[model samples]
Every structure is written in C-alpha cells, then in structure tokens.
Target: MTTRPARRTRRTGPALQAAGIGAAALLALTACSSSGDSPSAPGASSGDSSAKLGGTVTVFAAASLTESFTALGKEFEREHPGTKVTFNFGGSDTLAASITGGAPADVFAAASPTTMDVVTGRNETATAPTTFVRNRLEIATLPGNPGKVASLKDLTAPDLKVVLCDETVPCGSAARKALDASHLKLTPVSYEQDVKSALTKVELKEADAAVVYQTDVKAAGDKVEGVEFPEAAGAVNDYPIALLKDAPNTAAAKAFIALVRSPAGQKVLTAAGFLEPAS
Candidate 1:
C-alpha cells in the first residue's frame, strides 16, 4: 500500500523572495511618509531664540547716543529678560581708542564713519559697520536767549563764551566743516572732548553756547535751546555701529545691534531729532 507523499506546503525560492520584496516595499513606503512629518528642532521661533542670548553686553557708544541708546537698552533688556546692557558713553574717537586699546567691549557705535574707520582699520569689528542715523549740527545756547545767540555767526561774537567739541571729534569736525562752508572764522572758548561735554557747558551755564548735534540739544530738553544753521546741512554726520570681534556677549551684542536698527530704534532716534539714514 503506497501512501502518496504529503504535499509540501512550504514556500519555495521565488515565493519566499517575492514575500521578502513585498515586506521591503512596505517599509520603504512607511519611511517616505514618516520623513515628511518630522518635528522641528525645539524652541525654534520666528525671531532669534531668546535662550541663545543671556549675558551682559557692554556697549561703547558716542555721547550723542546716550538717551536714545539707553532707552533702547532698557527695551532690549525687557525683551530679552535675563540679558543686561551696560554702556560707556563718550566721544566716538575716545570710545574707538578704548576698544582698540583692549577695553572689554561688546559693541561700538560711532558718531561718524571716520571714527568707525579707526576700529575697522584695526579689524576689530566682527562685521562691516552700518550707518544707523544722520545728525546735523545745532547751536545749543543758554535757555531764554541769555546770550542772544541765534545763528552760527553769533557764536563768533567776541563777547560770547562758546564751547565746541575738540577738532579730532566728530562734532568738532562737523563744526569745522560748517564754519568752512560759511566762510566764517570763529573760535571757541573751549574745545570739549565730546558733544555732551560741549552741550553741558551751555546747560551748566559754564559757557554761553555750544555747537553740538541737534539730537544732543533735544536730549537736553529745556536745559538748552537749539539754533539751526544752514551750513549744518553740508556737515551731517553719519552715525555707524558694529559688533566687536572679541565680544564677551556676542549673541547679546548682535541682538542690541538689531534693536538699534529696528523701527522702534528709528522711532527713538528720530524723536530725539536724528535724521533717518539713507536706505
């Protein structure tokens, strides 16, 4: 009695290969669909991540930027929460010298491109400096016209006690340009190192008048009076700012620079009498 061999039910060569290929095709399809649904890196946002910026940013800025930049600094700190902004406000040239001389600073904002050139020439900036605003000269005089000063020529009155910025500074250089444009020779009773010091002379009544930036007079409020002169148009100083190459707070420094260039910053600067820089 020969019993027929049980029919083999096992999958042979081609059938096994076909099944394996089908399994692989399913996995490839699964992988392709999952790839399009991956999540983004955590904490990513439209703006720079706040977590990336938390440190003290030391800013060396021109005296003329004191009020506006200080306001912006407060806003910056408020926006950044844990970040702190410190400032050293003085003449652009003085600030540049300090930075070039190894002062620990994160950013530099100069009242003139020439002063900024001092830093850029030394390759101290992380990036090329950008002009943020333009400022024209204005004569800051004692309130109520105590000196009866009205024009740039009046600053030349022999009886008038006038103070100007040191010729090496931006304000002084602009003053010189304005004077040269008007073809008028006027000497100051003193040459202050920065626009603020020159404005301070008039504010404190130490001098009868000062040739300074319109923004300075505006920042001083009623402490001084502003007088516009036509020659100021020819000597408008372009303010430039940059992030330092060796900034202690590189992230915070870059954020501060962005704030200064924002519309909010332009509002503060313009409200302080600074002219909008050309696009």
Candidate 2:
C-alpha cells in the first residue's frame, strides 16, 4: 500500500542533447590548446640547431674587436647558412650609448667592463655578460718611429705630437689609468674619441705618436709600430659581450655569442694581440 507506483522519469529532448554536445566540443578545444606549444615559448631545439636559425643578427662591437669579430661573424655565417650578420663597430662607450638610446642591436661586444656596465645598467642586456678577451695599451708610433717614442714618459715630450683617446672612450680611460699608474702626466696634441681614431692619427702621420690598445696596433699592422709599456699591465681592459634584451633574432644572436666564446674565436682574438679571458 506504501508503494504507490514509482513515477517514470521524463527523458530530455533536443535542447538537453544540444547542451551535452556543446560541453563536449568545449572540452575538446581545451585539450587541443593545452597540448600545443605557445608561439612565444623558446624551443629547446632552436638554440643549438643551425637549421632553426635563419635571420639577420646585428652586432654592435668595439673598434678594438673589428678585426677579430669580423672574422667570427664570417665564420658564424658560414656555420649557419641563410643568416646575415651586420656589424656596427665604434667606441664601446658610444655603442653603449646608442644601444641604450633605442638603437636596434642584437648583440653588443664592448671593449671594457665599464662600457658594458653602461648597457647593463640600462637593463639592455638579456643576461649577465661574459668577458671574452682582455686588452692592454701600447704606444703606436708612425711606421718609422720618427718620434723615437719608447715609454709613457716619452709621450710627455713637447716635441712629440701625441694623440690619445678621449676620456669618454674605453681606450682613453685605460690610457689614463696606465699613465696614472706610471705617475706620468701627458698633454696629448688631441684626444680622439676612440682607439681606432687615435691609432688612425698615427697611421696617417697626423700625429707623431698615439696611445692605443695593443690589439689596435696589431690590427694596424705595418701602418704603426707598437711600443709596449710596463704601466699597460695595470690598465688591462676586460671585454664583455652580451645579447641585448630586445634582440630581434635571439636564436641567431645566442649562436653568434657561442661562436665568439669558442676556441676558434679565442684564436682570432689572440692572434690580434688580445689576451684570453681568465677561466
């Protein structure tokens, strides 16, 4: 008598069926999205694989790195076909300034740590920089050494038309440190903005002598004669290189940096009179 017949449940029609189908479709889309990779994420294979790299990487380097980096750039291009490398070489300080001022550069190879600091301080570097090479100063005399320049003290001679890098440049700062370490005060005929400029003056015979980097003198070859001074040891310049934070070609940029720190890169720099970075 308490079992009044159990009521039969009503079955849902097309509306309920449609809602069930919609929910299933939504879940399928979610699963597909979750399984795929995001476009912005870095691919593990892209880093070391040359096939994944194919774009222009612009490098801004110090004048001192001109010869060495140029060689490295060519090698990089050879290793990764379909990649183009464009270089802008100048004073490290100037390059740092340009990069900080919205210049488009994929990589920066500075002549000194202080110059690299300029870019790092501005949050321009993607990662902590690594020192690749070091350099020391030398007096670059005309081909014939007509000034008879031999030491830092010889640069102080009134008869000699000595040129130095402007204090704003890395080479100039290193030159200043060198002169100070020697307790030598020199009044140069002019202060060129970069080591290359100062070296160029002596190469062109515009100045009787110039205080430039040993690398520069070596790169200049027969155009100038290098005179190593004892004080240069105290003013060694540590070159730091980094990939820019906003690099347009990050894959290629990283590869280029790897090449620069490679053994081949070191050989080129060492051949150009640059010292190897301490391990």
TM-score (all chains, Cα) for each model: 0.82, 0.82
Candidate 1 to native Cα RMSD, angstroms? 28.0
lDDT string, candidate 2, 1-279, tens digits:
122222112233435433323343233323433454232213311136535688899999999887677766766676678998999999888889999999999999998888899999999999789898999888888876777666788889988899999998989998888888777898998998788889888878899989888877766656777777777788888999899999999889987887676554555567667998876
TM-score of 2: 0.82
Q: Tell me the lDDT of model 1 at 232.
A: 82
- Candidate 1 lands at a TM-score of 0.82
**lDDT agreement with native, every candidate:** 0.78, 0.77
Whole-model lDDT, model 1: 0.78
